[model samples]
Target: MSEKRPVFPEFDPDEVSSNPSDNRSFGDVVATRLSRRAALAGGTAAAAAFVMAGGSAQAAPRRGPAAGEEPAAAPAAESGRHGLLGFRQVETHDRDELVVPEGYRVQVLIPWGTPIQPDGPRWLKDASNSAADQEQQVGMHHDGMHYFPLGRGHRGGDRHGKGNERGLLVLNHEYIDQQILFPDGDEEMTGEKVDKALAAQGVSIVEVARGKDGQWRRVKSRYARKVHGNTPVTFSGPVTEKHPALQAGNRPMGTLNNCSMGVTPWGTYLACEENFNSYFGTEDPDWEPDTLQKRYGVDNVGFGYNWHTASERWDVAANPGEVNRFGWITEIDPKDPRQTPVKRTALGRFKREGCMVTEARGRFVGYSGDDQDGDYVYKFVGDRPWREHRRAGRSPLDHGRLHVARYNDDGSGDWLPLVHGEGELTTENGWKDQADVLIRTREAADAVGATRMDRPEWLAVNPKNKDVYVSLTNGSGWDSAATPRDPNPYGHIVRWREKGGDNTATSFHWDIFVLAGDPAYDEEVKLGDNLFGSPDGLWFDADGRLWIQTDVSNSSQNLPEKGYDNIGNNAMLAADPRTREIRRFLVGPRGAEITGVITTPDQRTMFVNVQHPGEATEAWGEPTPQNPRDVSNWPDFDPEGRPRSATLVITREDGGRIGA
Candidate 1:
């Protein structure tokens, strides 16, 4: 269908041959979002005008702040309402250290292998930590996270009071770096190696607070704990009837590849299971995946994890049903470890990314995306409101309707319900009931003609106007008019306003918020100074500042030929919703992707994660012990040190609001 292209074996593209072609692309809506004539002009005023219009030409004006919510935390002199950025913008660079604007400082906290408890095993620089030790230590590749104030009850934006000085930080460990994990450098597989790798993923809940010196430190509280691949998980929602595919002994063994996350109004943490299929493989050399398994990406040989070699738990040939128990949205209560982690099946599953929940008409409405190219975005609408559901001793998450999004060529979209008897989701299509529909959510969305997105990664809701935003992490197809480059390496973010400003509305209007790329490579650069690619994680602070995190693949971070050399390292930027004004706030170390971000209630202390530093062990050259030059060895500057993923706490020298 097109000209010859470079071969990338690891590239995950939209592979469904039967899927409808998506030509609406950035060319269609982006030009309309700015009026083709205005977009080609590339003038700052038109960009600001589009942003001030709340992303969509048909969208209503921005709504006022929610009740009891804090006031907008920032406003610099001469910036107008949202014009002036509070912090100096940091330039993109390839330094081996984390950098922030002047007058602000960064302190590395809780690096990987740090003991969860003070009495636990300390990290050994020689990579000799046992599998058991990993269970009690910080996990690898820190991602989406949140800060809950200590000594208080969290309820739907209520922190019980103004206690942000101390809190519990809950984060996700996406995956492991096998190259650095084993001292021998990816030697033959073993049960112990699999155990250690599995134990380093899932979620980490650790108590941390600022000391008298204003430095944050991890606290050894009773609440500090780790939930990993060995942790027992329970099921809830429409698919809790002990389906055969979900048979993993009496209970499911664990959650794998925990990526981005979300939080419920009642304060429970939602850990998204992304790339869960990589943990499964078949012992049978000639094994093949069934239709359902194929759609979910189950294969005979998994991206080299090789867990099946040592553990039947991951051997799909031995226990094929076990693979179905994963790919779910796991809920963990950080305050009480006694409560079991619940996989909310009502949300449906297909390599779940981030689940951002908002209160829609006293009930819960959750938004999530299936983080793969040509996948779909979904939302769950609860039937019962919060107060009534809680009084009746029910979880709002356990009773809801999940629907996939369908975008039109115009600037509008629809949420088509995935019910058992609805449309093609009937018994004739292999969907016996709602359980089957959710187990194979992707195909159901496909059956209903859902719009295939680039690589929907994360979703965030605005605090000021309740609008929604999603970061599409590039694609192998779908050419964009905003950029002239081929292959569209850098993705863009989209914003939408529900019909009549109601989050529960089944229809909405959308527009392209921004397209990210470096013009030097013949691709158009939309957001200057805040230039970035591969937008992965997103969050909106109390003051309505949209925080964006980049996830440039480690393989291309330093390669100029891949079109990312101009956008060095990864970075975190802050954007004002009212204007297209965006400023880079932080830049991570070489080879690392800046991910997972949050700040205190007062917006004073901010936490950002530096993940996978010193990645891609040399592609332009070969490596040897005498000249083994890794991309970077951050935090630990010793020549013999290993790069470790960690969280950093940033605060102003004057203790003022963050992004100020």
Candidate 2:
């Protein structure tokens, strides 16, 4: 469903710009290919590495040396690699491996097979983990993560570590590789693989403390928890009580595909669920015109892996009616591991890729990306101002107005209302009404006319400028010759400054911050346009340095030979937003995507996740004889040797703050 431009609230394009080429600050002509097939194809290419991991795990050689064989190094301190710039790029590769500047060390905090629950089953190479046991262990495909200092606040007896303030590392288990994550493939997934897979797809909260030698270890604390498919969720907001699809005769269920996360102003964590719609396969799977089904991508019975064939199918195990629960932004209070997660249904559900908060007029404004081809961008305006009190009793998310954006042909834009009981969304237009608007929001946005964009993925707010930046993934409609307009072809990064210094305002001035792509592509693609292409995850460090991570997995054509061909794997770059200058900082291993970045408050430690390495191969048992040429045995198997999808710690050799 697409949103139509509403007549009530009028916007002036001329006031936003004067010259055609310079009218809109965003580069509309710098287009990327956008197609349903393209999106799926991209997933297939990226998912291949994970498939191989499964195949090799089952048939490969035995496990090697036990844990802790490597000696612990001194706590991170000043070293030559740390230099004046402060950050030194240590490891770089297209294959899956962890990298750190010299003088800094890297270690695996937790492995995919680690036992998290008291009774969680030990993971075996042949794929024998059970659903019930998995509920107690850590999930798979770890992505965005954040570390929080605990003990300073929390309930009684639950005070974590003492003087040192032992902390919690919250990770997002993005998705599962049915092949490697399981024993054989879906063919061998059996009862255990399905259950474990579901259990591994949510959030993993583990306690971490600096060991006796200054290394970090997962501390055995009551605060450690896992929220997955079976975990209960609370539905609160406009659509909670009335939306036809989500009503469930009661409330929503769990969260799936928790790709990226956000830290709220009040200190709670916001986990965004992406690709939730793909899990919902209906009873009458043949129903083509189903409204709820169409809006949420639930038309097919089984698109690839027939998860329904398994015992604990979320769509069927807890009432097919309950699948409506997965897409919204769910908030988790790390301090209290036992409390239920809240699905802020007010923020219309789609494939929520990223969620972020910025202070505006004292109130907190939440920004998010729907992560679908041509989907709209959204922001939530909280009713109350954010208080600095970090005590354990408050949650600032209760009330807010959710608005969808309409980017104009010119640089400026307006926020269209997706509120209940307002404008054409009422019960008058043969519609099921406002509740429907909140549940099947894409449809409601279409009825109102919000501008369709290239796949909207990650969002970043520049701490120095208060300007918002969004990574627009690759699009098919972005062809420069096909569209004539400077539509984002290879996808670009867009930015906007709130009007009159108010983020909660209904309108704002905007521009194309960086037209992501090869400078050799086209002069028009150049946007006076700063440099870059296919921008993905974005974050601003404490020192006002903006880190731009590229999602160029599909556009390898743009990269030059020599240093790039053998070493490039969707890198994380740093840019001075003030000067629009960007430099590549870190790269990922083969078949792996770099994600989930964070730096310690003092900037001494930088943590990052290398996801799904050595992706393109078949089952572990099938000998290389059949599929003669496939990349397998990732991170650890590389001729260079390493493990797939592991979190790494990066620190400056000189021991100053990162990016100095």
Candidate 3:
């Protein structure tokens, strides 16, 4: 990929808050990941290393927690009465007023609409946010986030071990829901609303300090910054220069719908652009559907957002070509706010939902999901070996070939390359060439028989086993069958092992790790003993404990007897993958989907987001008890109240590791 095609928010240090270094060690870890910049320059070295290590079939099977490496077990109260199935919620009466269990407390460090820049407009109810100013505000709908402690000044190591005082916090500001964002409607948003909403859609780079009082607060720091939608981002790797997607404007601008995020082994943050397709409008009405577009996703919608009617006419003003700029994995260096983020197009673009980086045979492997009906799962293999450049302070992310997965009838698969000039992709029945194929990757994946999946959302690699975990929602014809069977309808957590025992291999084996259902009675629908419903947000603790979160939208109406009938909303589950045992750990307030889980290094503090609590607008009210004046006041202070989307932090009643 080439860096010439810039398409992200520009770098602006003046827009950041100036705070002193409190967590230096944590920053060092992040800096180390960003510094190792050249190992990814060559692809053959990484490919060979995987082959030399012997393929997947012969490698040592992953092991679970060893005898003494585990933290002391959490007490019964924290673990819940149902043994492994219990989650104690935290209590708080902040802006987001949702309920948590006893003995827990949640702090709203940065709520939705919180300003990121110093002089940014305060998020008001009337919608005064603008695009020019959006560059200085916090992005909306915060989703997947990770808290990394800064390393000791420049000493390169785990800051948590050295009792470091300061650290850099990288959080993702996901999609901006137009309904609640703009005062009237998306079409009603004016200058300010548009700007504010755009600014709130990217990532926030801030500094945090653990006060002597034992609480974490946003440090009054210089590093507090917001990377808005219009930031200048460089394009790099694989499909960068040749694709029509990149051809949109010589350079694309802004990243929209950033959802599930990934932290590289090297340290920089990977912010994925999900649901970006909804932002673009087709200028070429005669735009014949490419075979690749038809296969991957792009064929359905014609006219997109009529930005002229809303705030900041990104569609009409800035660059109408701007829509194509989105939908790539953007890499950001949190340590140095001055660095420009890069859109790694080699990863393939389409409603990209998540990025999970893992290592096999000393190579870097990345797994991403396209969050659309019947989309395909894709992975990238770096060209060079993933050496301990981080130990030496460097970033190894430049070279890699993008490939899509195909689940064969025999239950095996191949990682078909989407590169423009080479592989089986070049000699196909359709595409002009490899570059043509990369531009329409979804279509190309279909050309190769890649298994279509239900809207694939978040993805997390199992820490202990090194298996890739993917969340598959409803399936569209392009990715899977419309009915519930092998891979559609009732989505499951799909896991796969790289074929060459290396992260960069072109083949792998896969299976449904866990299926979602109501285990209490729906045996036919539930694949596992601990049956649940629609699995969405997913994360793995340092100990490799797989935390599965749910996103059941319609509530009681969707699941009548699945135990979700008029009760607790979407819940979070902690499962031991090795044993295939899953237990509901925590549930959110009414009408909210549980998302974005991140833990401190010690695993003591867990942060989760409750998105759109009072989603059912009709459920909200005028003078009735059901209809609260403002849905913003949630996690309800009054037990019998409306719901709101807020961030919830959870920890043990005994100050121990969360899932220990």
lDDT of each: 0.75, 0.58, 0.55
Clashing pairs in 1: 79-84
lDDT of 2 by residue, 163-279 (tens): 233567788888866656654456643556656677878888877766656576666778888888768787776656344565453344567889888988667788998876555
Distance from true location, Cα of 194 in model 3, Å: 2.6
Cα miss at 653, model 3 (Å)? Answer: 2.9
Task: Give the worst 10-residue stretch by lDDT in candidate 1.
Answer: 1-10
| Candidate 2 root-mean-square deviation in Å | 14.2
Give the lowest summed-lDDT range of ten residues in model 3: 34-43
Where model 3 places Cα greater than 4 Å from the true spot, the runs are 1-103, 117-135, 153-165, 187-191, 238-251, 282-305, 308-320, 387-396, 421-424, 427-433, 476-490, 519-521, 525-531, 555-568, 617-632, 635-645
lDDT of 3 by residue, 406-426 (tens): 654333457777766554466
Per-model TM-score versus the true fold: 0.89, 0.76, 0.75
Task: List the candidates ranked by TM-score, beginning with the highest.
Answer: 1, 2, 3
Instruction: Evaluate model 1: give its lDDT.
Output: 0.75
The best candidate in terms of lDDT: 1
**Candidate scoring better on lDDT of 2 and 3:** 2
Residue 646 Cα positional deviation in candidate 2, in Å, after optimal superposition: 2.0
Give the poorly placed runs of model 1, Cα more than 4 Å off.
Answer: 1-84, 152-162, 249-251, 479-486, 617-629
Candidate 2 steric clashes? 55
What's model 2's lDDT at 163?
Answer: 23
